[model samples]
Target: MSFLLEFVRDPLTVGAITPSGAALARVATAAVPRTGSPVVVELGPGTGAFTEAIQRRLAGRGLHIAVEVNPRFAQHLGALHPGVDVVTADATDLAAVLARRGISQADVVVSGLPWAAFAEHRQRDVLRAVVAALPPHGVFTTFAYLHSRWLPPARRLLTSLRARFDEVVVSRTEWANVPPALVYYCRRPVTEAP
Candidate 1:
């Protein structure tokens, strides 16, 4: 299925004008552990743009669960990435999603969600769930379009991210994506306790 078709059919859910490119994928997966049997949760892996990068990092040792709310995209993702434990569900229900798979905590969460396009409350809800699903050493990564970075919703999402994670590392602008964007790499603090 075409990425643009999904976006046109459901703009809010699809978000991006095009699937993310390799540059964005590399930056998004930068913090994902390349070693160890880590548990990964990917939010909105629309069209499997970030799936390849994440899967490579997992290297068959880790669990890669890609969660998509849209059934259309979810079906395509499951077929496209058979190794992934693809689920047709919302990111806000991270706990139940992982619990159903008999997993408790995720080592990393790489999101393809368009946080800049989402409502403030929706962003917070999904992120809070992500924080709760991860252990103290877990890492969360997501991207915000450069054009929308200063928007009220995007700004709010950043503030929410800082409050939840101990550190927030912004990647250099990725011009390879349809609309240039930068990745937000976040780490949970061992002592602060999310």
Candidate 2:
């Protein structure tokens, strides 16, 4: 499905005017562990952009699951990314989703969720789930449009991330994507899970 058509269907959920391309996908998942056979969960994998990079890094090792709220997009991901466990459910239900697969937690989460388009509470709900699903050393990665990085919603998301993660790093701008973007790499301390 085209990005424009998807955006027209739901602007806030779709978020971007274009599907994330190779450049954005690569940078977005750079923080994920390339080995360890870790379990990785991808949220909001529209068009399976990040899935492609993730699959390459995994190279048939570890478990890779995807949670997408949109049925249409979830179906598309299932069809396009064979062998991927695509669950058509909201990301806020991260724990339940992993539980269904008999897993207790994820070692890494790479989210394509449109943070700036969501309400602050919704963002917190989703992030809380992400944090719960991840181990203390787990990494959660997401991206924001370079132009909108300083916007109120984006700033708030950053603040939420800081409060949740012990360490957070921002990547250099990836100019190849539509409107350009940068990746946020986050890690948690050895603290209690929420």
Candidate 3:
């Protein structure tokens, strides 16, 4: 109900009408490694759908920082999952956010942002921040709703991803999710001269 309300209030930031389902969450958070103490950064984790799966994968082993733009969502998530370091900030400030925590680079970055709702420049800026926050070996995972995959914004997101990373793998559609979605696992940040 809260999720729907938020979405209705601001579709661009809140994205979906409902929180992501378990199936989509699992697929989106697959990039979080199980063995090491990895610094995982989650972007736009509205209502912590992917946050729960990420915490499960971490199993009390690593730093899980969730950066959400909505203060309401951030506060609720921080209270529900005391384990996560929830920061109320924009995704484009990923580098600065990690820097403040003394994290030089994140091992994995999982995003629940609404790419299809963003303008081209916002999408590029956010993706650049993600790439900048990651080391070469770091992995970045984000999802796109299957129904909106062909939209201009979605296509721009794909183009941005491919340009930033050496390898971008699109996962199979998570049919169980509402409206269905697919995950994009990106690796090897291709840092460019500014």
Candidate 4:
């Protein structure tokens, strides 16, 4: 419906015609601790697929900020999930987005961004922002569609993730998802030497 329409209107931003399924959402958002409050930031949470799972995990604890580039998606998500602090903005501005909220670093970052649709430079820019917005102990989780794993953009994203984080663990492919997908759980941001 709206997801398909958004994809038709802007394939590059929307990426997929359907939202991620519950199986993928659960695996992707597993980093959000069930106990203790943690600042969790969700990038490109279109239609709040991940947002719903995150809120369930939080169980009324922690801050959930969803950054969406599409205003329609943002507004829809905000109305549907009033608990989330939905911001209509680009993912590359992640650091500043958190800063404006009087926060320094996020404990966990879950991304539903379309890395494969982004150009190489745009991918790097967004990854740099994600790394900057995390502390050394922070965790970052994102997914790549299995069908596009060997594509240049996907390869570039994996390389970039490896460079930014000390450890990047790929999850078992979630076959339940349409077209299937795998998650990348990254920990320990590798700060660049000055």
Ranking by TM-score: 4, 3, 2, 1
Query: Per-residue alpha-carbon lDDT of model 1 for 27-119, expressed as tens digits?
Result: 999888878888889999998889999988778888899999989889998988899999999999899999998988899999999787788
lDDT, residue 108, model 3: 96
Q: After superposition, how far is residue 149 of candidate 1 from its true place, in Å?
A: 0.6
Model 4 C-alpha lDDT per residue in residues 126-165, reported as the tens digit of each score: 8889989998889999999999999999998999899889
Candidate 1 TM-score over all chains jointly: 0.95
Best by lDDT: 4
Return the clash pairs for model 1, or none.
none
lDDT of each: 0.87, 0.89, 0.93, 0.94
Reference-based TM-score, model 4: 0.98
lDDT of 2 by residue, 1-194 (tens): 77788889998888987889899999898876777888999999988999999999898989999999888889989999888999999999999999888999999999999999999889988988888888887999999998999999999999988888999899999999988999999998324423
Tens digits of per-residue lDDT, candidate 3, 154-175, equal 9988888998899999999999
Candidate 3 TM-score, C-alpha based: 0.97
TM-score on alpha carbons, each prediction: 0.95, 0.96, 0.97, 0.98
Native-to-model Cα distance after best TM-score fit, residue 32 in candidate 3, in Å: 0.3
Which stretches in model 3 have alpha-carbon errors above 4 Å? none
